[model samples]
Target: MNHYDSIVIGAGHNGLVCATYLAQGGQRVLVLEAADTPGGLAAGREFHPGFHASVAHSVNHFSAKVASDLNLAAHGFEAGADGHSIVGLGTDGAHVVAGAGALHNASDKDTAAYDEYSALLGRFAKALEPSWFRTMPRIGSLAVGDLMTFARMGLKLRLLGKKDLQEFMRVASLPARDIMDEYFEDETLKAALSWDGLIGSRMAPRSPNSAVLAMLYRMSGQAASVKELVNSLSGAATASGAEIRTGAPVKRVVINGDENGLGVGGVELASGEQITADRVISGADPQTTFLNLVGVEHFDIGFTNRIRRLRCNGLVAKLHLALDGLPEFEGLDRPGGRMIIAPSMDAIEFAFDDAKYGQCSSDPVMEVTVPSLDDDTLAPAGQHVLSAHVMYVPYELKGGWTDAARDGIRERAIDTIARYAPGIRDRILHSEFLTPADLERDYRVTGGHWHHTEFAMDQLLMMRPTYGAAQYSTPIPGLYLCSAGSHPGGDMVGAAGHNAAQEILR
Candidate 1:
């Protein structure tokens, strides 16, 4: 018999953000979650007794900002010990942690040449970041907002007066592979940086507009992994006097419609109980929200068409492990930072083509991190958490996620690592391979897309999900979209939820 100001469906990090803000603004908010955890993709879980794993997301880009804003630290928010991923690839498997692009060719006889070459891309990121990270717009269609942002960037470059503008345009418009070719002679250096262009997408290094994907996805300030960001988000939500129920997958949302047509009424749950609210915000997928929860008949054709067209594809797989000791790469026991198991751009491209054709690569590119090497708490005493981020595995891969093939892909990816980390096989204690299917089934990622929708320029901003409807406000008033699918393109900052809550308050 209790009522509230808002009911937020889905306790994913973003949904929690929206709920916290609403509640902080004096609105009583209740967050409904289908999963048993608060962080949709950002939450951590105990993989085994005395061990936890980040199943969905592992880093927090700009998580510190969110934590500070919401006072998450005061609410028992714990910091993960390590900060960087140690990376390298190929026969040598040379390694460096942060800014690995410069160190990929660390041992190259052509060291001076490689340093100068990577410096160019570093400068490019410096120039490109401001344009891509502008404050989000107030209201507009997603396409128009992107164009406006793009044009504003163009004007800013134009003011640079011709020569600077020419270089800016070249860096902005050049294919990442093309840019890589212009700089590094070594294939591994090229492969490593080019992989950044394909993070969380279905694009290859040589793909056009892939460079922009590199620029857009990398815009987060402090968050490096999904785990860190969700930690901040979950912390913030709890601080606002809100309750989060993980593993409480809501079976259905009951609607109380007024015969007089006062724009529908409060919602009910699958338990056949009524929970009234002045507003109900859906933070799950558009398909789950409109069709599954609201019922398809409630919306007209245009709205349904737009919702149906929203792209939700999963193109990556994350595999985690606990090791008895450190994996030993050749001359890489101290493999400074992040490891990139890509030998050449062609190898990355081949994996890309395999995924596009609906098959996982027998030899896929892997980014590996052994966090316990830096932090003691992540594993049992003298043990480590081996995290591998394997990309470009299609949602509908050939041979499916049969335990055998999935294990084979796991072996291949690890074998690819063995080429770099020679004795890694000996340190193995336990392994957990999560294919795209596991991600979708566990995180409700629709098609295993870490992002609810593709981040193609067309699907950004207000055009996100639908034209003129991307800024949180839906066709039905009171409903809002605070997921990464909304705006700023899901780089693990709860910006969408944070932004949406601000709008709701206004």
Candidate 2:
């Protein structure tokens, strides 16, 4: 039996980040991944001949602190420049471009309103930024460290001054629709601005409580390509003396019982090899880690139920198109930057309404990115890859995900895009459509949720993945969580992994 100080399951970016930190702290760490490569959803795969795409197409808010601490640039990952524009496509060749502190192609009133909106949100995002990197204070904890964390959080908000603090309180819980309506008039611009807040979860523009917080969470960092970020993290982890083994899926986390109750012994691989370790840190989603990997026999009834009841059925699907050449948009010279394809907030809401009943959205909305223009490696010379996040595609489709259903949604997505770029259909060399169920089966994520869990108010901060295990430490001794399902929630941010390592090392 091989033995080590810790065994980190899954080589997703977070797992690699955790392993890197632990190894740097002088612990013998081994990372095991079911996938043949690292990066989890961020792993680039060849979908068609000479064309590649990753499920997670871009990194908008990956932690700069994690990159700096791991020296990721030395390993070939540099954060892209800030202010990449987000384009809202209009059917009649009118589009709105947002970023760099300006809103172009919008009404003078809206453009002026945008500046004030940006400044207010910027201040709020800045105040809340530190909390994402730090371990959230556990509720009802009197520990000096925990208390200080709370104090610092309160102090940061108070420092925003009387009026801004009041505004933050008022706006943080408003639905994305309300916030957008308060500042913008153009429907395209409103929907485009709300995209960041509502993506990757079971949320629409009108879903209140956490959308604004989600947007602010995303506002902290610049964008980077997933391929570079993953490669860099993998390089840094291995360089720090962590051994990562791919294609090794853990069947179960071995448990042993004693007077001190149950604890992790190590893990049993699907191949039947059992390796011993002092600790086991799972990078899988909470339900998969506890209910599937660890087994329900070890957990109390209440905790098991909570894990099962987690609202994690993903509503987003990924669409990847291999184009023979760049498809020109009706209005734009080139489809540069992140483009959004929802005409209005009502369009998004109607899609969400269809999905709420377990049906695929009849009129789906999406965020489109032509990544190959910036990275030539994604496609053949002069060719391109169209990567899109198609939303309101239910994991539990009305009739379940069938070949017919998948094809229907795929065609719908293509048709929606074609409305803006008429030449897109002819340019398609191949298409890869992955529904949420496909993401679950292929990526090993529960419900195919990119965040592993829903990024809602009840499922965030101290209550994330539920109370007993919210701080990374679980009820089972020597077992910890380092996945996006932990503390600061998802999106390639790396804070969960970073915070988990700090807890383990402390």
RMSD of each: 3.9, 1.0
lDDT of 2 by residue, 170-196 (tens): 999999999999988899999999999
Highest TM-score: give the candidate number: 2
Residue lDDT tens for model 1, 246-319: 54555555554454333434566666667777777878876777777777666678888877887777787877
Q: Give all candidates' CA lDDT scores.
A: 0.67, 0.92
Report model 2's TM-score to 2 decimal places.
Answer: 0.98
TM-score, structure 1 vs. true: 0.85
Name the lDDT value of residue 350 in candidate 2. Answer: 97
lDDT of candidate 1?
0.67
**How many clashes does the backbone of model 1 have?**
41
